[model samples]
Target chain A: MSWGPLALSLQVALAATALATALGVVLAGVLARARFPGSDLLDALVTAPLVLPPTVLGYALLQVVGRESVLGRAWESLTGSSLVFSRSAAVLAATVAALPLVVRSARAAMEAVDPALLGAAATLGASPPRVFLTVTLPLSRAGVLAGVTLGFARALGEFGVTLMLAGNIPGLTQTGALAIYDAVQANRDAEALGLAAVMAAVGVAAVYVGTKLGRRRVHGA
Target chain B: MAREGGALAVRVRVAGPTAERPRVDVDVSFGVGLTAVMGPSGAGKTSLLLAIAGLVRPLAGRITLGGSVLFDGSGSWVPPHRRRMALVFQHLALFPHLTAWQNVAYGVPRRSDGRDRAREWLARTRVAHVAERLPSTLSGGEAQRVALARALAAEPGALLLDEPFSSLDGRLRLALGDELKDLVEALQIPAVLVTHHLEDAQRLAARVVELEAGRLRSERPEGA
Candidate 1:
């Protein structure tokens, strides 16, 4: 019945959602507007995590940031702590797992904007930044919010990657999902059910809000 | 008033997307008045306006506004935002997310009185009553005036309009066209209005240019 795991999970999900939302909006904007060679390939790479097994993604992340790797060594030298099995590692795992939701939703929203509107803005003497800020971004508000909420929900439910990268360290890297797994294995059915129910409630609420926003977008359009 | 200069000169060739169509060439000059570009659908009238607006690049051409070079074939090109050109789209592409006043005020310098200036333009266009409404809530005529107000707020060196009266009925078209022509004349800036309607062309323009299959067919000056 410890609250530590739930608090840590919320922290990881929130941080990961923030990172994913920022990167997703930028990448989505670029992907939506850019016309160049290898753009398709880059898009596929960003989305690969969505289709790839979480364990495989976790394993790949481990290879790059594990304690024996160069990046891990550099991190240890700088921060005097190993990269793997840390709370930051959990955040990274959740971010990678949740990024596709944000990118897909945000890109769809950005692409839905009429090119004619952009042309009108330009003709009105609006610079590129002005057009994006005043026209493009504001028009795509619903989609962006939907993407952010979906990413948060996805990050909250991430288990396989969290286990592989951050491990199940009590009062540390162990998030809601990991704690649930531990509770079930230790035959603590009551604690497992409590955590699982709370996780499901938050996840469902996020999805419900996201769906409502998406519906509102359709009605507005 | 616009700076003193000869007719805005344009001599350009646009390579069509397909080889079968080859190119659409335009050789015309527009003076400080409203000139109507009339043609049937798919005749590239809109393309010509877009080219002048810097939204579409011509294969080879020079566009000079007043004495300033807007574009030339020697890799000299100005991005659309810097071209000092305003376009009122056929569909009236007012920013749906913004109120009529905000849409008109969008390109104004970020100063305290920018909104006041926008309201002035809206009042001039006679859409001040709808200034607080979003484009979606405005009627067709109201939307048209709002779009015009937004364009005029830019104080563009040139104006390009794509079928501004297309969405309205015959009577409404003529009424709106006449009002639009008066606005253009009062501003004394070079303008190109693209339309497929001969009536609109004859009514709104002092000079009418015809395009057929992507080439300029004729230019006739209406009697004063």
Candidate 2:
């Protein structure tokens, strides 16, 4: 029956989606364009979260951001902010859940761009950065946009990682999914059903948009 | 004009997959105007331009543009953007995300006060109408013009093309070929165009260099 928990989840999902997309684009560019000895390994490493269970990722996050680990200590020292058990932790969890979606889409977009166009840009005297920004990025935009939408939707549905890592703090860490869980446990049937219906509608819209964009890509080919 | 330097010189040796295999070896001097480079499949005509553009490295060779060394053995290679050489790829690799003008803009300096010049370049190439559309929306011939316009925007010391008119229909190919020939000469930069089609070679080039099995066997004028 807590509207506050629902709002927290919504904020986490939205913020997580935005953060994941920013990292995803840069990761996709490096994966697709940069050739290094461990490039493929790096790609696999980034996508590792997709196959990992959320609980396991939560456990890993607990270790890395527990205020005891070196990285966690350094972060706390630098910013005086504890990410663990906070809304930021929820965002991080959602980002981990959604990252694969964005990176996959971005990689496909980068690949769809014709290499010849890249070549022409290079020959036209554009530097590597210029060519990628002006030609490569613009060409594979549909894929990148599609990927971002899907990542956001996926983040909205993330459960285990957000619950464990952020501890479902009422009105802060509780996302829409967690709010539904909370309502179900407390026997608040009407509020649970309402939130479920809204979530279902959002889910349907996301699927519909993703499917339409996918079809356009197939036809455009 | 390239006349002051005599010709654009390249000695390209490309090693792919291994250091043991004999790389694609080519040494040639191209004159002031258009020179058609005809070769069989896998003959490495495209490889030559890639080396000049700094897209590929020659195990041992040198490329000099307008009497300035662009590449030499042992890591004396210039970056592609600074080489002052523009290339039109056989695939007509126009930027799909950008409108035609934007693609052309990529070739020139970012702060180039040359908006009018870019517009005029599109007009001259007869693609001014499509200037607002992305490359994906363009027909094959239209994409080719955008590629050429982007190259022209750079105004490089040498112009290299890999199958400039390969994908177009006959009429379009011939028309674009004529226009490109006229334009490259007007600019007076040394140019090298590659093709398997003798017709494309003859129509656009005054002299021809034939490559077979990674070697330049002969050079001849059109039809004799």
Candidate 3:
């Protein structure tokens, strides 16, 4: 079996999960703590991807970052390459598909942290940033870790958005899921089965790890 | 400017959650000793402490610490971190993820021998041997001591205790209160202890202030 699809799949999922985790953590922190008008509306928008059609999300991405869009034009000019139908495009697709998983899980985790602990930290002379890094972030480790794992699993299996934004370019944009699709289309049953097994194994592993992490609550936390 | 080791004057009003009692007000001052704020449940004693600690915003009034303007009605308020005050929570809230030593060291600045200072405070509070233990591993009394040590390790300008002995048994509460009173006196800083128990308040402070229905009622010397 060729290693190209597996390698590309891992690369895209890793990049996507990393991006999602970064954005998700900051967004979750704010969402968990802030009380302002329209906070609920903003929360719904962030998690909207979970319920929205993947193709619709992909179409939205295309309208904003497609080759003809301003961002895409600038990106292409700077990088001397088109943004769509590339490995980075696959990463972008995977990121969008995985973002809601990260945000929902992380926000829940952050919200579970006791406000009293934050109050104690502040009284002990820790600034807001210090309190978050030293107290809030450390205490929310289980949720953050679980969120990253779930996001990675989602990214690994992302198909619809990827097909729309990054197309299945063999040995390039073809992730494990995309490769399985290609194999089945050509009636390559053995290759399809192999790729499917690999994807399933990855998904199962991610889910198992995430479950264990999320369930391991801290006593007195 | 306020004098060093001077009093903390608090005269503030905060909006409560309901329309019936639209506001809660606190009016008091502290010199260099423990001042217990005693009240029954829902009397807003803790709210007064929170406002002084900068954890809550007051709708009007001011809190002056050692003559410095900690908060003023004219849109001037210092954030909690810069307030130079330490609060010991009833539940202890001893950073469950950190060991006793780490929790004590948390507020100490990284510079100026903070680790040694933490160890010193831990020893002072009689919890030096449990320095490596997590909060969950420690008993209620041990955790309380650690909380006190952590607060003192910060070398704060003031200290606030919110029902610090509420979790302990009756016997333990008295014993711990005696030890705490001595500790607070040794530190020579203004301290506020909020408690629903009259015994706890009288045992720990020479002056006691009473609150009822979100309003400060009376302050008197221990016997009165």
Sorting all predicted structures by TM-score, with the top scorer first, yields 3, 1, 2
Model 2 alpha-carbon miss at residue B102, Å:
3.2
Q: Is candidate 1 or candidate 3 better by DockQ?
A: 3
Candidates' DockQ values? 0.62, 0.43, 0.72
User: Which digits, one per residue and each the tens of the lDDT, describe model 3 over residues B1-224?
Assistant: 12147577899888788756835686788878899988878888888888889998988899998879999999899999999889988787789899899899889855366678889989988889999888888988889999999988888888899999888897878888888889878778899998888877776798999888888788878866
Best by DockQ: 3
Please give, for residues B80-121, the per-residue lDDT of candidate 1 as tens digits: 999878899999898888889988998665546669989998
Please provide, for model 2 over A145-213, each residue's C-alpha lDDT reduced to its tens digit, 9 standing for 90 to 100.
788888878888888998888887666677888888888999988989988888778877886786566
In order of appearance, the predictions have TM-scores of 0.94, 0.90, 0.95
CA-RMSD of model 3: 2.1
Q: lDDT at B208 for candidate 1?
A: 93
The alpha-carbon lDDT assigned to residue B56 of candidate 3 equals 89
Cα lDDT for residue A145, candidate 3: 90
Residue A139 in candidate 2, Cα distance off native in Å = 1.8
Off by over 4 Å in 1: A68-78, A218-220, B1-6
lDDT of each: 0.87, 0.81, 0.88
Write one digit per residue (lDDT tens) for candidate 2, span B1-224. Answer: 23243368988778855665444788888878899999888887888888878887788988887768889996787888788788888776665556788777777654564566578789989999988887778888888998888888776788888888888888998999899899887888888899888988887799999987678889888877
TM-score for chain B considered on its own, for each of the candidates: 0.93, 0.93, 0.94
